[model samples]
Target: MTKTLGRRLFGFGSSGRSAARNPGGATTAADCLRLYDDAAAAGPVDAELAEAAAAVRQLPAADPGMTDALLALGGAALARDLPPLALAAADAVLTRRKGSRAAWHLRGRALEVAGDLAGAVEAFEGYLERTDAASAGAAEVTARIAVLREAHSWRQDVVGALDGTAPGVGALAAGPLPAFEAALGRHLDDRLAAAGPEEAAGLARVVGLHAERRRHQLLPPLADPLQGGTGRLRIGEFRNLVAGRSVCLVANSQTVGGGALGADIDAYDLVVRFTSFRIDPAATGERTDIHVTGHRGALNWDRRVTTRLVFSDRPEDWRQALRTRLVPGAQRFTGDDSLRRPLRTVGGLTPERWPAPLTCGFEMVWLLDFLDVSPRLDLIGFDFFATGHHRLAEAARIAGPSDYSSEKAWVMERAQHVTGPVIALR
Candidate 1:
């Protein structure tokens, strides 16, 4: 991939400064068009193209008003499949308007398509925080963050181009390709890891906090606000409503076979399932009394489910999606999943301050701790290890039992304290 990026990124017909210099910082709409046309036509005029690129780079530095035109040029470059150029254009815009949410989004999009996942994550983070908590496609951006966080978990096997070359982060721009860029990413990871917890956590806060920040609902305390304390008024009331009724937590594990125990699960007074996970009455029974999720992807099913919800991340957005579906008695989780935050911490994960981990099954089990119920907590479809027959394996294909070992140990050590009689169906 690094070789591909270099081969495609470099080799621009010999060199950028080969022939003549056109002098950069030309501020004009015509200059933008000329640059786009020159690059798109793929002529052998490296000097002309280089000069044009240099000129585009000067747009934001020259004057603040060029942001709009630079944005348009960046959009054009993206449409033409020139992601690097698009990034440059967006960077130019950011230089002038550092807090420009649109520019951050543009940079994030370009970096993602260009295979710079780390840069993409940073840019997207900047965008989310720059935008005032409410914007179009925020859900999609949130989902993208959830995925990129997962990608950052694994290390890349990188080798320099030269036989016996020492690995260094600086070599990313000058090394013999291979996984040079990915090596830069690893180097960044290593540097951050070595930077001590305080500095590391600061950067992490930038990435994680904005991704799935739980909007605190500090109205009136219901039931001590320290135990079984939830943000939604309906949820607090539901706890009183359900009182001592038994609640079941079901996951989409191979054990369930897509609703094979629908009847059994539905028998419980309250049934909770994860986000985007479907339940067929024919297979698992359709009693989605309460749904819990940490993904923004659940935004798509807003109108689909009239059942109550408990969100960890993007809770504010969920409020808008389920506005009509919500009733006065419905409950929500606005940053009150105290159980989830600690679970991620145990797994060596910040996970965006929500239950937005690779597999939320364990988090689901732990979720029972936060509910306002003392009923029997029967768990189904939870194969602590992924080495089981999952009825809906595809839903969790990208998700694996990566962190199950430690999480399992955590559960075993404290299962007895989980608010009710714990029973594992698998």
Candidate 2:
């Protein structure tokens, strides 16, 4: 793969680099492109690719193949979980060719990963302007723009509430203001009618809270607000239950449906499943020892499941889930936002280099490792969307913006080196 990509990129034999080097042994465009291909063939975190990207960025804008190299480098950076570098490469291409639709699309994805939701929307709009509206690419971009716009609006509202800038937001800190809550509920209902499934869930949460007269919990607290006295198992208690037990994390990938591994899955000492997961006695097991979910969607699990973990980096997400989704008398737990990506602590990456929001399936795997699940941790239906099918079609829609490529790479690397609770991708 490396040789083929290198040859195609440089228009030379894989072993040939005659024109790639300059008279003074300085790097050339061909050299940088070849480096990029090599790095891409390597894993997601290749030092060579980083160095090549830096060298490519330094090349003169007017140099031959500079735009092509930058465009390719931008995509490679995104795949490698380096959003800032990807954004830089996209900007470089746009500077050279303002009408580059591919560059705009790349910029949109990079910005989204970097948490610049509004910037991402603008970049996607730019891409739309250059694309044929009737084309499939345009249709996909249109859907993406809608999702980003909704996310951006939600973020703005949450920020306003947090900073006490929105009208009546100041009253939230004091306690529930019935009048303000009623007004917000009406507003959310109007938006929910037009929202996509993902956004509608959040909007519905606010409306539900208002209806239930739990308006005071609509906004997230400034700190970890869950306590031991709240009918939740403490960290030690949760560890004691599953720390050394053989665990199986069943994802919603379609591959599991074909494996007929229901009995095999049930064989594990503890079975963990995600939100809205399906149960087929012949394909997916019916047991649910632990139910892990994100902020979105209503809880749907067997009543016998004792432990439920809500995973989200945003405080509002888990906070809302606790109020709206948690089943009464269930053992509740929430994931720490600091461990959401683990790029900074585990991979030695800066904030700019982290990937986009991960799926709950991947988060659960990481959480188990963090919680010291021992002996062996088996994974099923976790091909990272490689098969292009999910047990629930809505899940695919909800996870449309997640960075599955980078997550898959990270998991593969973890499986190789993780000692305790040795990962086994079944």
Candidate 3:
């Protein structure tokens, strides 16, 4: 597979310049049309492209139609490996039209080229209903649809056993993605043969976590908040291939709320502590930091939030461990047999603070950027962070997981969703 190109590779593009340059410049609609024509020219008319781009940028915040046109131009630039221009154009469009299908579609394509499959999928799916199969931009829309469908199908198949859609004990027994499954299983079997049972057990924990992550899709936790000894919170795991870090260390956790009042403070605190571990840090002397940002959502609606942390240099051994633990149970694919078994405990710390009536979730992203310094990262390290925001509401409405009463716990429950901002650590 070809890698995503960066802004540097495309010479001087829009991202290279400051947003202030054309803040008060004279860039009109006609100027954007001219800029589009010039960008399509053969040689490096960097100056001309910049001028036109600046002009186009000024238009998006003023007019939606112009914003769409700029997004289209950005797509064109991205197709030519002009990362800087394409991204800037997309950024401009997205800024004004945050939920615009055209903006998201264009950004998705750019992300794909940047080797950000996860981000690309997110953007593409965001515009799913807007892009028609036979529209003027049918090709781009269709391409995105194809990519998302394949990835979605694969994810569903891999996690099918976990969801009780299949009756299997492990991935191999699941019989989904036969070839990929086999390869993963074989690799794990060999590793297990060489590992101590404790290490093997740790590996198993990783595998189980991987599946549970997909089964939840970063939704708020669905468990009794006070069930486990440490007080329960729903957790999801996701791995991202970030390009600028090394080792699988927690980058940071961010939470938003009303001054951390009620159960939110304790809940957010638990997440912060859990995700800040220095996984295998001794072997790779790289410093990993986890920054937690918090915000408050409506207290009555769905109180769900998404937190994404970068895991640099994830170990392949982790993936191997997962394959060993899950593949064997995949064959019987018929029920939640795989999840019915408790996950082996891995080397992680649970926070001491136990918060009540609060929910949150985690997106433990295995950032690809960290792999460069910590080459041990594995394929199983995509993006499987966890969440527990929903747990609080469930706790409020219904009794804890151990409490089997079917009666509602809280009538006027609001969901507080948190979405972590992308923190680029260069």
Q: Which candidate is the best by TM-score?
A: 2
Per-residue alpha-carbon lDDT of candidate 1 for residues 95-144, written as tens digits (9 for 90 to 100): 66678766777777766555455666788888788543543336558889
Residue 184 alpha-carbon offset, candidate 2, angstroms? 48
Off by over 4 Å in 1: 1-231, 299-307, 313-359, 370-372, 385-401, 414-426
Using lDDT, rank the candidates from best to worst: 2, 1, 3
Angstrom error at residue 230, model 1:
16
- For model 1, give the 10-residue run with minimal summed lDDT: 14-23
List clashing residue pairs in candidate 1: 235-331, 254-389, 254-390, 254-391, 259-283, 259-284, 260-283, 262-284, 262-285
What lDDT would candidate 2 get against the real structure?
0.59
lDDT of 2 at 91: 67
**Model-by-model lDDT, in order?**
0.50, 0.59, 0.35
> Best-fitting candidate, measured by lDDT?
2
Q: Please provide, for model 3 over 1-426, each residue's C-alpha lDDT reduced to its tens digit, 9 standing for 90 to 100.
A: 011223323433222233222221343445445434444453454453454455465654466446645654575566566544555566565565566665566666665554344555666666566544433234445676686566545545445534532233343331212333444445556657998978677567435644464455558766432111111111101111121123232221211211122232222211221222222322211222222211222121211112222111122332222223222212211111111111111212223322222221121221222112222322111112222212123224432223212111221121122123212221
lDDT of 3 at 77: 67
Residue 249 lDDT (model 3): 22
Candidate 2 per-residue lDDT over residues 42-94, each given as its tens digit:
54446645654664667675775566557667666666655555666666666
lDDT of 2 at 246: 89
Whose lDDT is higher: candidate 2's or candidate 3's? 2
